[model samples]
Target: MLQMLHEKGLRAEHCYAAGIASIGAAFVSWMLSQRMESNGIARADRWGIFIGEWAPTFIALGNGLRTYEK
Candidate 1:
């Protein structure tokens, strides 16, 4: 997968940027859900947590891509 990603021109910097963006997106989604839903803060928290989980995967991918680049 890493090889494929590298071949596709996905650099470590891209993944790192994605990771940071996802974190911000997660926070935004949480706030949006909180304001728009009746399920309240719990639902918002879950939304935040779910999106927040993607950051690690992106960061890990960034690391893997860095390795491949080397």
Candidate 2:
């Protein structure tokens, strides 16, 4: 997967940027869910959590890609 990502031109910087973006996205998702969902805060929390989880995966991928780059 790491090799494939590298081959596809996905650099560590791109993954790092995605991880940072995901954090912001989580906040936006939480806010949107809170306003739009019937379940309110609980739903918002879930939305926030789901998106927040992506950051770690992206960061890990970034680290892996960095190794590949070297």
* Residue ranges of candidate 1 with Cα displaced over 4 Å: none
Please report the TM-score between candidate 2 and the true structure: 0.94
Compute each candidate's TM-score over C-alphas: 0.95, 0.94
The candidate that achieves the highest lDDT relative to the unseen native structure: 1
Q: Summarize candidate 2's per-residue lDDT along 1-70 as a digit string, tens digits.
A: 9999999999999999999999999999998999999976987899999999999999999999999999
lDDT of 1 by residue, 1-70 (tens): 9999999999999999999999999999999999998978999999999999999999999999999999
Candidate 2 residue 42 Cα shift, in angstroms, is 0.7
Q: What local distance difference test score does each model get?
A: 0.97, 0.96
Looking at model 1, which ten-residue stretch has the lowest summed lDDT? Answer: 36-45
